[model samples]
Target: MLWVKAFHVIFVISWFAGLCYLPRIFVNLAMEQDGAAYQRLLLMSGKLLRFMSPLSILAVAFGIWTWWFYSFASGPGWHWIHAKLLLVVFLVGYHHVCMRLHKNFVAGRNTKSHTWYRWFNEIPVVLLAGIVILVIVKPF
Candidate 1:
């Protein structure tokens, strides 16, 4: 169980690292006027997404293993776990949205400004903070 928790944390951090940076790449892509730079950023984004997708899957898998096999959220008064799970769902949706955004970028149909992406880039940070607080503080 401890090992499961450790791996879960490790993969979660790895996944978050990509989540935090992908949108910053989008910001660069949006702001880039040079065709070469835009293509370079797109290549970077595609590679990052490919790498992060497995991390996200492993993170969620280990998380569910901890919860189901180890009964991490089994007892009463585990409302914080419920809240965290909801946030996790939202985080997954956000990841999907990023994929769609990347597709839009690849299709040369992106209309959002760099400023919008800058704001979008902060989303995972806030979600991470909320998740950590819920897990550590368990403030229901």
Candidate 2:
């Protein structure tokens, strides 16, 4: 079980690393004007999104393992877990939105400004803080 927890943390960190970096990539993608730069960023974002997908799956899988193995879902002081799951669902949605935005960028149809992406980039950061607090404090 400790091994499960350790791997869960590891994969969660991996997923969060991608989540943290991808939006900054979007920020660059949004701001880039040069054709060559655009192509370069497109390649970069595509590769990154691909790389992150499996990490997200592994993180969620390990989370499920932790929940099932530890039975944390049925335990007291776990309302925060429920909330954290909800936040994670939103985080997954955010991930898909990033994919869609990538598609839009690929199609040359992106309408959003770099400022919008800058704001969008903060979503995961805020969620990370919320999730960490919920897990550590287990605030009801």
What do the candidate models score in CA lDDT, each in turn? 0.95, 0.91
Query: Per-residue CA lDDT of candidate 2, range 1-140, in tens?
Result: 99988999999999999888988888998888769989999999999999999999999999999999766686677788899998999999999999999999999898999999999999999999999999999998
Check candidate 2 and list the clashing pairs.
none
Q: Once superposed on the true structure, which residue ranges of model 1 sit more than 4 Å away at CA?
A: none
Q: Compute the lDDT for candidate 1.
A: 0.95
Query: In candidate 2, where is summed lDDT lowest over 10 consecutive residues?
Result: 69-78
lDDT of 1 by residue, 1-140 (tens): 89999999999999999999999999999998669889999999999999999999999999999889746676777889999998999999999999999999999999999999999999999999999999999997
Give residue 113's error in model 2 in angstroms: 0.1
User: Can you give the lDDT of residue 23 in candidate 1?
Assistant: 100
The residue-level lDDT of candidate 2 at 91 comes to 91
Q: Per-residue lDDT for 26 in model 2?
A: 84
How many clashes would you count in candidate 2? 0
Candidate achieving the largest lDDT: 1
Report the error of model 2 at residue 98, Å.
Answer: 0.6
How far in Å is the alpha carbon of 4 misplaced in model 2?
1.0
